[model samples]
Target chain A: MTDSKDTGEAGEVKKDHGVLYIGMDFGTSRTSVSASNGVRETVYSTVGYPKDIVSMKLLKKDVLFGKDAIERRLSLKLYRPLEKGVIKMGDDADAESKANLKAARDLIGEAIRIAKPRADELVYCVIGAPAKASIHNREAIIEAAREHVDSVMLCSEPFAVAYGLDWLEDVLVVDIGAGTTDLCRMHGTMPEETDQLMFDTAGDAVDAELAKQIQDTCPGAQFTVQMIKDIKERYGFVGEAAERVVVDLPVDGKPTPFDLTDQLKTACTVLIEPILEGLRRLIATFDPEFQAKLKGRVLLAGGGSMVKGLDTAVEKAMNERLGGGKVIRIEEPVYGGSNGALKIAHDMPEDFWEQLK
Target chain B: MAGFKETLKDAVRQMSFRTSLDKLKKKGVQNVNVLGVDRIIALIEAAVHRSLKSRMVGIDRDAVAESTKAEFLRLLRSNEDLQREKSQIEQARERAEEEIDLMRRELGEKRSLLRVKLEQDAMELVTRYSGENQAIAMKVAEICRSFAESGDASVSSVEERLMELVMDVVSGEREEAEVARKALQDREVGNLQRRIKKLNDTLVTTEQRLQQASTMKQFDRGISSIYREVQGLDGSDSHAGKKRELMVDLFKANLKLQKRGKGA
Candidate 1:
């Protein structure tokens, strides 16, 4: 074990011999990295390359990570990791995935450097992986984290969300991240393998569905999944009849009015049934004594939770079938998972981690 | 004094006798040289007075006459025979000179014809390069226009169009080279076939003069392809993917000389 330190670049340097605890939430859509000894920041998980070798040399860098990377995409090669919460190995998504995974590692390493731990410091990092991460993907993340941290452990994303929310007893946690929606039923202890369910259809899938619908309804509408996501984030509403969506779509080299009311509504409704099923199945797992209490405390933690009228839609669906339940949406998006990992890191004794490792 | 006087008188008589012998030797030498002889008295008497000189001469008449007469008869026979031989040699020399002149004319005609053909070929090559470049520039520009107007700007589109362009250039150049080369080759093959036919006809006629034990070497396709490709010609007409597949097949067929694929 080594002591934590901050040698004048920023922050106070600790003189104690205690080890630093770093909490990392390595999400498919975004990564939230934090250190318990006061090193934390959230960065968008994206990497970009300059237009040409000349531009790359001029910038003195080949790739850029995070929000700035997305903004300079016309002159860059943009990369996104964990498409639908799993590493894509097929020809369609292989190249983007490999680059994204590499970028994620680079980002984590950079964040660790900012912490500035002492030479003797044994950095213990807890990284949050997807709830349904395959054995191979889990190993890959561990290998990636091991490059920077002395010791690293990978925990499920929804478990981290539930831990961060502090609803550990008889609570059903439904985390809808950009990749996949995960449901974990915690009964005051470590979740059993049978206690969790994962669905591949999530926020990003909905965005793709919306884009496809828009293209089919309005021919010659130039739109990518990212653009669809932007629109969804801004005006995605369920269980309501809104005015006709009139947006400018580039058609034959000119901007044209594309009325996408039916398309938008149909697209947003794609994930409703799956989410309702996931919640119904998870809540049914609670023993008879706590079933009613657990039903009302169904927590939703992720970017997808921000979809308008999601709680209401879920509440309405549950009310009609499974009696009554409340959909609780988490306010904090950036550090939801990392905060949970930090809590674990702070509470657990160093000796307890030694046994787990 | 007496010895000196006697020596002077002997010298004067020897000089007169030597002068008379020289005149006779000179006259005798002419006929004997022709007759192929050495003895002077026998030669003189035989040449100037054959019958009378042979009988009156102190030297053996029969021996001299027998030899001289035999030589004269041989010379007379040779002169008659040489007239016929000289006529034959003159006729042969004249025919050989005529044939040599005809050969020189034929060689000149071949050299001039080859020079003219080379000049024409050089001009054709220059024209072909200019035409191909112009065609390529125009076609590439047109394809690029379609690309710019395309809705999808994916790298795949550019890759596909570029592949098409490459295929067109490669295949077109291939076809042109093949057609040109084939035309030349077919004409050459036809001419060679005709020459072979003529030689075969001559062979049939002159079979008795020829050795029946010898045979000509067979034509090799492998060696032919090497020569064709060197002149920018390919055997197969397949383009793009098909061309690659055929080349793969060819490579597999010639595996002993090639780096074999993993499966092979």
Candidate 2:
């Protein structure tokens, strides 16, 4: 409903149609969105531009994202704009950095678009950022999202997970993302800088370890990082082998099967040590009475948390080291952060959204 | 303005069927020089100026340039005229489709009516002939009984033979008339069949018109949002107080970051 109309440059105007609250998980490997309109979608955090004029004409697109970017990478100059759950560009203004910035901006737009907010709707968004993200990183994210949404805010990823689950107090959240794993302790209040720990040993690290293992053991097994990521997402496990992790890789243009059970277990289990260490430090430093409570509710979330048997493996490790601890893996680990962020967007006061706008 | 430039470029590109060198070679071309769109436009402008310089005096050159500019505007106006004509053609196509639908319904109705009329005529003839034959048989039986009642064998035999001959002659004449009537009915059926065939041909022609109309372009339909108004935090939630604090903190942080960004 339009209370008043103001003529724009070409006399363009729009009604105050509605409000759309979007929650985005801006991850290193994947970006996900959840909207109030019941739209939920995820895309890999990769952007690609066609390499040359021929490719530009053939692909018929100026840019591609997610599976298309990965699948058509040979014809593209692909850029993973985000690494370690933040924009990769630094203070130095180089060509590559500027390109990365554009790619990151496009990626943010793409993520919001996939949420499918109506053109007339006012889009208010909340993004789950890494706890250790710099102020510059937060500003960049907000700036990128502003072009597509009316207003936006950033919340720590692990805390978003904790908030999503309503485990606001006495909960230890371990969010294992692709580039970084974030650990935050919830104490029914805002988590200060000291209450959160972030580390780089995460899904990408697992992918690297798996790649290394494949190189050492399965010689001549031709694979790309994209292929490795697919395999890891499909069959990555820790602690024990459910069955033999059998996958086919091409060797000199011939298909060959490799047993990757040990490799996958070894790589996936790398998350446990960092998580346990972080959990120990956070729990040790928490309030004495709540430390036991926090230890009892170790919430495991994120895409990296999808590794089969990871929860049990981490639980088993906690028993050995922390005397006794409980580990709980969230349902829908891929959308945990986004779902929480969406809730935050919905809960944020209307005045705050208007003020930001 | 950017969009308008892209539109012009697209129009130029669509008009020119440019091919790659590799494609030309595949088509058995020995060698070909490539020309880009920018160069092609430049060459056209140069050719126009060259023609004006070579064929016209100083004032005439200016006059020719103005005429060429006028011609370009005329062409653009004609293109708009063509667009209007296209819409008119589309409306005619829609009318043709409606006529086709009407014809199809008429054809079905005509076919059913022809079949029912043929069946009714056949049933009427059968009932009439059956009644006439029954009446004639009764008359012949009465004549034979009357001759027997005269009590003379030879007279009765003579009358019976004569009656048989009369009955055979009349029956033969009736068969001839029946044959003539059947021929007339066949002619009527043939005429109806011809009309049906013509209707079928027209139906096919109109169907093709419909297929042409089906190629019309479509536009995008936007999605609808779930909320008509902003839904802030629910007041009844038990954790409303705690979530409010978190929301305020998040807002404060974002406000600061944005303020700093704007300052920068």
Q: A25-87 in candidate 1: lDDT tens per residue?
A: 776677776675566677666767788987687665667777777777777877775677755
Candidate 2: tens digits of C-alpha lDDT, residues A1-357:
111342122212242677888999999999999998898999999999999999999997899999999999999999999888888887998998889889999999999988877656788999999999998888888889987787898899998899888889889899999999999999988899999999999999999999999999998999999889999999989876868989999999999999989998888888888898998999899888777788899999999999999999888988999988999999999999999999998888989998786
Worst 10 residues of 1 chain B by lDDT: B221-230
Alpha carbon lDDT at A71, candidate 2: 91
Judge candidate 2 at residue A109 and give its lDDT. 94
Clashes of each: 2, 0
Candidate 2 lDDT over B1-264, as tens digits, reads 343334445546756685777898899999767787766666766787888898776556765666555544434444455457567667867798789889989899889978987898789879977887887778777766866897665866877767786878598769968986776668667877888999999998888867766554221113556878888888898999998898888888888888898789
Worst 10 residues of 1 chain A by lDDT: A1-10
Relative to the unseen true structure, what is the C-alpha lDDT of residue A194 in candidate 1, on a scale of 0 to 100?
81
Query: Could you give candidate 1's per-residue lDDT for residues B81-126 as a string of tens digits?
Result: 5446556555555555555455555556555655676678789889
For candidate 2, what is the interface RMSD?
6.5
Top-scoring candidate (lDDT) = 2
